[model samples]
Target: MKKSDINQYGLKPVPDPKGNSTGKAAGKAISRVVITIVSLFFATLFIIGIFMFSYIMSLRGEEIDIDLHSLNLDYTSFIYVNDESGNPVEYKSLYGGESNRIWVDYQDIPQYMKDAMVAIEDKRFWEHNGVDWWRTLGAASNLLSSGGSFGGSTITQQLIKNLTGESDVSISRKLKEIFRAENLEKKYTKEEILECYLNVVNFGSGCKGVQAAANLYFGKDIKDCSLAECAAIAGITQNPYAYSPMNFPDQNKERQQIVLSEMYNQEKITKEEYDQAMSESENMNFVFQEATETGADDTINNWYIDTMIQDVVSDLQSELGYTKEDAQNMIYYGGLKIYSAMDSSAQEMAENAVANDRNLNSDPDMQCGVYMMDYSGRVLAIVGSSDEKEGNMWFNYATDAKRQPGSSFKPIAAYAPAIDKGIINYSSIVQDEPIPNYFDDGTAGPNNYDHQFRGPVTVQYALQQSYNPPAVRVYQQLGPQNAYNFLTQKLGFTSLVGGGVDDSNLGVAIGGVHEGVTVKEMTAAFQIFGNGGQYNEPYTYYYVEDHDGNVILDNRDNISTQAIKSSTATIMQKLLTTVVTQGTGTGAGVTGWQIYGKTGTTDIDDNSYFVGGSPYAVIGVWTGYQNPSRLRNTNASKSVFQSLMGAYLNTKQLKQFTTDSSVTSAVYCTQSGNLAGPGCPTATGWYERSNMPSECTQHQNTNTTSSRSEEEEESSSSNTSSSESSSSSSSSSSSSSSSSSASSSSSSSAA
Candidate 1:
């Protein structure tokens, strides 16, 4: 058969072993089969590459146009005060804004942090360009097996997604992320890409970057992060809320351990370091940054900003017709400049006074609210609690909490109205005897703080001693509806419940309103006396300006209304001054400062108050509990008041309360509410000169003569009764005469 002839199977004959044609032909057959298979494989690969390219291109419509520069970090809006030189001297952030983030450079990042992130997130991070194909395949397998989605995002790909806002979980979105990530890797170095990723990732609880996370979790810089802290932070990238050390410490510890184990298995950390990190992770303590209800960053240890933000939002809504959300956005992102009336020096002093008080510092449940304002009604300093670290309860007790004013409410609710109506003066006598069923509910009427009452006491004596009965008598004389009107309308305390004739009873005189008063309201009410009856509305921020310097709101123009007659305020001031000098509020006295204030303790001692101030400032301090538990001592509020006011007074010059021309000083018999007579005991008092009372009838000429005759007869009879008793009886007569002489000597002592 020919060399190319068919063998038996194909009807062609086989060639000999030495023939080159046979060997060459066999080799060509094998080559043809191999080439065909190779061509088929290349065709399949080309089809897949084309499909992927098309899918990636489909996601490039509007997303590709995003500007990376727009994602840069921004600072939150703040309440700021300028110095004498017109430069920002002090400021505090209005927390819970969108930009509560801080950026850190790649060089400043710790090595352990980078290693842990790479180990847990993408094992082939260094080997791949941007997308880890192996991780993607594994993630796909995990999704299929687990019947749920899984993330395979490399650090660079995450940066692309964050920067471009392509966060949807679709195949097209993944392709877009992969495409953009490759482009990012080409445009920047690996270090730059990693740095941007770290800075833009969310660490939850309103922390938006690694630096903020470091500070919020450890209260330290990113470069100072230990291995365990780094592992914990790295674990948060997977699920920040679920793995938060503050919210879920145990789950966070578990995730942290996984990161440490991965680091050890990958040889990114030594065995000893891995073991130490694992141990520390189990006992990690997180010191979260101070944040508001909205989870925005705030100045550490400064809680006043929370209240300041609330006021800003409300003012914005009322003045500009903006919704709450719109107002917050405007304040946070509109670059508005807030000028606050807060005196930084005074605020620091007030905060320190409360924070450092041993009584306040020792008890966490005991809370204090202090509001200090200047005579112009600008809030100078306010603190909600002694410890700013107290949980997330941002209720600003100074302005938001309605606590009983106790005896502090007396001057506003009772005396001011009584004096304004010419019904009583500081020297006018009021029966101090117990009132019967004053509430009409069979409850006994008010009593003196000492639970003992003198038969008849001057108004000054009653107020100085904080005797509850006198205040209740004055309230009854003024009527409930009238006192409520004076408090709500005249003094701008609109928070008091009920109105008109159906208002609260005599208890209102001692802070027994439906809803009590806030420290801010009480302070403003007291300022009425200091400002000579002019009620200046208490406000914090003076003005706010937008980014373009257009004034959005300006409160520099003072808003003052006449809350009481100047003479009435002067009389009230005189009465309260005696309180500080020789009354229940003597603990608040400062030498040469003419300090005037009142101390108040509620019936059950649940609330205590001291509202007093110098001529330069008015301050109100309250000590109480949220649920109203009796304090260990009623004098607790007094100590806080002394500390705060003393610190404030030390910074100012001595000033005195201005006297009104309509007011005149006089001597009157406290027993009869009449002018001083020859035999009547007298007390110095303030009265409207035109409204002075009549001469004393309790010690008229005939009665005085009769009383003297009776006393003389009695003395003679006692002396004649017994010689042995005569020496003792003569001593008694001399004592009686000395007492009468002493009673006639002074005019201003308490009767």
Candidate 2:
């Protein structure tokens, strides 16, 4: 033996004297290799076992206890409105209160549906303990081959996910799901798990559970679902949004075929049944449910409920810090009790008033909206449209529709702000003559509705008659930016058009806004007059309680902010009263009640509006074609207002408007808007004591032409009125010709 061949042990190296040492060495090396491989295999298995045990232990502390019996498949929240006695009356469901949502037990579900679900979702659902290892391995293989994740979740595992809300697709989430599924299987029977899965799974478009899906898609109960319908519903479980029959009909039909094929391959359905189902699915005419804009099922014909649901969801998100999805889920499934200020009698009256109006009912395309609210801004009633047809039922014209308010917006955008700023009083004279193009360009100025000018008139008469130029003058005096801020910020008119001061032109005073106004907004704004200048944000629900009877929102004493001086509101209310008595709004007057409001008829008669109310209730009525067409009758809204407000006022005691001490009244010349002289015609005028104007100066015989008072002169008054008078100074001219020439000159100045 050589030194190099000696063992490292520093001992004499021995060899097999038989010359087979190499073979023997090789054989020993192979044996050692085998032993090492076996050891590594066992070590790997031990590590995996430890890891699984730790993972299982990690999930053991997680709260997985769920009250299965307390699960309410038939639970639905309700919206309660006040009855005549002021007690809460159940009006409708918070979630399709009138919709038919059937909850059937596992036995009641059609066998075809069960078969289809098992075949498409998990073929070995019946035999598996809680997971199907074979299917999981196949899924992993498929994932690797397709470079995408695949679902291998058994029905029990899905049930566990639904019950525990552990829906994340991570390793820990998968492990927890497995543990929960096993525990669930141990605690409940296979049939019970299936039942829970069918009842808890989410379908598309806010539909939950197999029963809801069956009704929403087929308009039938689960037990009555045909083979094709069953396959369609079962397929939707994979990707509800992608395979929704209403949204993706072609894709849903394709998925349905896959479900039918799976059932046939699994021998769950006969070949003949599969072929028939496939054929039917190819030409399926799904009776899909009509959903509101918020994606709730809209089987019931109530736009108010739809808007209320949206508002409730918004309140939940803003007031309670819940996500949009969470809030909607709570509304539909949390079984909350919502109390609203909706007066059922008022709602019925509003609806009937619009529906039965001869002007609105004569034209199918004509739509009318009526909204009523108390002085505190609690919505009493809302009628979105006169007709509730498929084409128009979803549009909430009262709150959602934005139409030009015409003169109805004058009080809010102009008079209220001007009065608040002490810039004008009811007795302040505004020249009702043609205004020149104040924009300094070649644009036409505003004209009265009849294209006729009435000389100097009091602010009371200007508002009552809906004189366009007077409002523009007042708006200019208040400053366009100041008026815009007051309207958009102070009064909460969010829908006004234009972004900057440049867009806030004189037209805004006359409702020539980019997106005019809604009936609800107008009504809410008008309520400020009745509420002594306090603006309470209009709301439907007074309070809301969660499923656990915890009060989430209590809006009974909602905060009210001062929009204007109480004296200003009082003076404006007095002026509005005269509108119903002697102005364009006389038709809206109810017997024995002092009604006040302004009438609005837009350019081309596109929209008609009459917004007014007594001290008890403020109501707004709007009548127009949805597509901005010419309306033959501009006073149709007045009629509707008269009908609804008449009924509403008749039910309550005639209440008088409370006068604020700061508001004062004085006798002034109606035509001159000044303190009455011995020979001047006079009318009663209300004014804010601080803003009352000086005694008559413009109408005095000697002072008529001696530089009219600056406040009484129109902001855009040119020498046009004087120039036209000079041309007609000839006595030889016929009286009618002189009148006609003066009118023509005024019209030319306006243009």
Candidate 3:
């Protein structure tokens, strides 16, 4: 017998009995078969009812994880920043859970859309108590004739399954699901149930719910959806993967017609509506966000996005009284609109600058990190890795990694504080020799690029040359604990967890703290010089608002503090300018911008760093292997740093550095580093009004030669150290540059 015939009716004898002798027995056997079939069918239903009753009793002692009363659903949150025109632009979006649902309120849902969903999913969804008796009877009738499995489930039943996260095909699962669905219908209103069904339902393309679907396929808000789009969204619930509006537009076209036809038949929509929807579906063309130039790959979380997430999460905990996990959940599902501090132009420039692998001049295994921010502590852009972006929520080198800053710490840990405390000035004489009682053995050795002492040098000369001994001498005078206090308490360097002993030494003079500094910390530390002694904590977002547009957290409360005296900062700023114009940082300067920064290379040349500021922004760049090893080339870091600096220079309006009234310039003796007298060789130096030096009557210099040389200025760019021990230098001077050029050829060939 055919399957259709068996489904249409109970078991019947095939072709009657061919022979007459066994006809009586055949009739008797057929009667027995029909009776048995009917008995089993009713028995199964009876068994299902009894099993559900038992399940209810068992549930009295043990509770399921799902709490029906809560009925919570998560939605996607967005990150935005105002563009040059001052209009908000979305930079990144974060979904609340693994399911990327963007919730829409019932009030925002269109009426026709609701009608289409009901007409297609469950026609009597408004009347049925979770399980539709009429539909169940028809499905049972079809099963009896065709031996087909049960395929009728109301919207309530589907919702119950979705809530429980259960997909078992067993009879027990089906019965339990049906009873729970009935319970759900009794407890919740039809509008509430329908609203949830639409939100939690998957629509493919990594989207869940009507809002995500509308945003993805239609590029419009759910409130503005057309009847045709509504039908398309409703059709996807049948099988999202196979009938996704984005992935399978053709299949969706056919399914959309079924939904529209059902809506029309049920009188949920007018004939005119049906006709217009049908016409619209005939030529439906889906538009994806990735097709636009502004859209980024949603799977990739770049540096700015990662930093914003960390900042928002931290603020959420403090401001809203939420745990870290809870705050994270609220961010993803709460439909929040976070106004971030990211500048789109700056971010693009920074990512392009660091991701330019060919210009990096190192193996793919080598990495680079960059952090950029303005004077107000608003983070503009951050690049954490050198490798091509592959996925999201990655390790951010800019914010997470605490690598040594090399000589970069000279300005922050030693010179800045020294000038602030009145222990040193722009032209103060410092001895370039070993510090006493600095080590556990009561002996100390100075670290230098060329491993040669320059004897007595002025403070400006020592900083421009990145000499370790002078910084150590000054660090000693400033006192290690005092410097530590200035770094942690004033500049907010969290990595200097000295615990009283580890960091109380000379290592900090050369970027050797107990722990290292993050690129973010190092960048923020430079803000004192950029903003005339003010240090504002680096932040990524301005504020976050709830779904209804009420402000929930305000991050604009971050205050700027006077990290150093304005006069001291002014003098230090001028000294840093000399580093770029006449010292190791010349290679990192942009043409029209007055770039003032320090260059630092480790004693072993394993890492290279450039931390500086222009009138527009403060930039910090680090290049080296993730594991501590000598750099292949240190020059590449400066080039990368210049590009990041140029990004801000070329985009923002140029503003000159603000000079304090207490800062003044004077001519000083090149030899004595004191006020110049008659017939004394002199150079200009800036000093605070209270800290001016006395006249240099002791100097009688006849030589009119320049105090610094052009050849020494080029040394840092060329003489880079390596793992093969080819050379050693901190921000190389020309002495090692020429020597290493000849020595590195042999090392390269041997390797």
Candidate 4:
């Protein structure tokens, strides 16, 4: 009864044609409404997605840091060298690679570089967010049947891909890139992003960026490159080899004209300027010298730069608290401003000195390092060379090398210290004979350079003559610790080699240490003597500036305290001076100036050194066989220092510059501790004065009874009191050293 009642509303359990028709119609209507709503929602979502994606795609990619310091490069290794007189010299590099290229900001880039790039790669680069929608659409439509397999990616898009390593190449990918590019545009100014792109994008031919390409295409840096040259570079972006002036001169020229025309059409350049540029382009002789593709054997090509890079990394870690990656980035991409002390002229002279030498050039087994510095202890030039490979300029002996300095180490270790202590004057007698038990051990035997000795020589003579036995004898009395301290602590040297001889003996004096010394160390030590015994830490940079020219680090006025006594330095100077006048350094003689230095030759003649300074410049030169074997018998007789000096002084480039206007010269008697010379005929001499007459030649003598002598007497009296204070200070220093050691031990224990 209940079932019938429930069904009765429909009347009976029977199929009603009207009811079935009504239900079917209702179901169909509901389905249609659902489908319509879903379709509308999806259409709305798709539109929104497209718009959002477009907005995002139009955004600029993140600002890539185009700072010069962010790239992997040698910042201070640039080509500018100057003497103390502020006279610049040209530093020439034989290896033409990106290492020599310099970066310019987008704003500073010549209109031609920008115009050419826009002309070839993306005309709308400055105008687009990150993508050119019209170009993309056109490319897609053109390649529609091929599924958007076309070429319309803008410079900005390519930059993003290069930076992010994104491989996606779909319509969707393009859309996403546009959105990202738009974001990048927002985050970075157009100038900044462009700089990043220009510095980072690959231009083929082993060139990763435009700067590298500029160097590869043109032997000069980007700043020095001309408009036609810029056009040639721009012409090659599409297909570097296809348009490379080196491989396809005509194609490259045609491409360059196209760039010039685009630049003209875009009005990036004035009509007259464009016409001139085009005219110049016709005669633009791109000297298409192929850069030595050294990446094939990274270990062999320019190993010096690699070693320098390692030091640069270490320095960045110490100075800027940067990781290895951060240092690499700083060098390759940071756009850092690096001011180096390198004198391009001196460097060129140094390089040519090695390259042009008949003996060195003929021998494929020679290695050498040359360094130059101003009187301020700042390095001005460096030449790293090792045996030539036929016509290839490949080897670098400067930074990668370490070799014994020989007698060159004596002036730094023995003479400087003795002068500082006032123990040995320039005229003090030093008998160059067989050193009797120089080590105070029966095993000790004194040896001379050629197994010969000069007898009863002055301290200056011994040093100038590079008499090894006298040096060893002098060192034996002074103690090995003195030499070690002078080298490591006073001279600021690094890397100490061990000798079996005890610190109590003369082994240190005779260059007994087996550890190799870097050219940097030799250069720095020489610079200290030149700079009045003040240790100006060798630095490549004078100042660092931000992109906006804000100084980050400026060491222009910074100078360290006196490392050795002025009197000691004076004696050492006199002796070194004689080196040029009468000894092994005769070839280094400069007629118009006073030059002082020591010549060094190790046992078996593996390494030879010349470290010297004038009021103008300090220079260090080293020569050796590639395998560290004895030099050729002919070379063995030849004075390495003399050769270096002859090359340095005779170079036309070096002759053009003057010393610092501020420098003043004078001489003092080393033995009597006075302004007059000792009784030696050669010792009595005229000291230089700022305004001495050309013929004025007399040593300023002092008398105890003279008025000036009274003043000197008073000054000496005061100095005696100062010395008493110094003695007390020495006691205090000893206590402090002991305390420091205790504290260090305590800290270690705590750790």
Whose lDDT is greatest here? 3
Instruction: Provide the clashing-pair count of each candidate structure.
Output: 5, 1, 12, 56
Candidate 2 vs candidate 3, lDDT winner = 3
The C-alpha stretches of model 1 lying farther than 4 A from their native spots are: 1-78, 84-99, 102-298, 361-364, 388-393, 498-503, 702-751
- Ten residues in sequence with the least summed lDDT for candidate 4: 742-751
What would the per-residue lDDT of candidate 2 be over residues 681-736, giving only the tens digit for each residue? Answer: 56677876766766775456753433333223432342222111101011111111
For model 3, the superposed segments whose C-alpha errors exceed 4 Å read: 1-72, 96-297, 357-361, 498-500, 700-751
Per-residue lDDT of candidate 3, residues 1-751 (tens digit): 8765775676654454457758888899999999999999999989998997887766433223454446665456888888898788987677545436567889999987788889998999888888898887887777678966555889877776566544434556666766777767666798888888877776655466788778777888779989999999889877765677554678889999999999999998899989999999999967753212223356446778867877786887776655553454455566889998888888888888887745474577778888999889899899888876543334677888877676778888889998998888888889877555443344445435655666787888787766767887887788777877898899998777643444555566666654567889999999899788999999888888988899998767888899999998888899898778767777788987788988767656666778899988899988878787877777667788888787668766877888889989998865677887766656788988878999987644645434443235334533332111222232221111111111111110000
* Each prediction's whole-model lDDT (CA): 0.70, 0.71, 0.73, 0.56
User: Which whole-number lDDT from 0 to 100 does residue 32 have in model 4?
Assistant: 100
TM-score of each: 0.62, 0.68, 0.62, 0.50
Name the regions of candidate 2 deviating beyond 4 angstroms. 1-57, 60-63, 66-75, 89-100, 104-198, 201-218, 221-304, 389-393, 433-441, 497-503, 698-751
State which candidate, 1 or 3, has the greater lDDT: 3
**TM-score, predicted candidate 1 vs. hidden true structure:** 0.62
Q: Residue-wise lDDT of candidate 1 within 703-741, one digit each (tens)?
A: 452232322322343322211000000001111011111
Error of 1 at 104 (Å): 12
lDDT of 3: 0.73
Better of 1 and 2 by lDDT: 2
Task: Give the number of colliding residue pairs in candidate 2.
Answer: 1
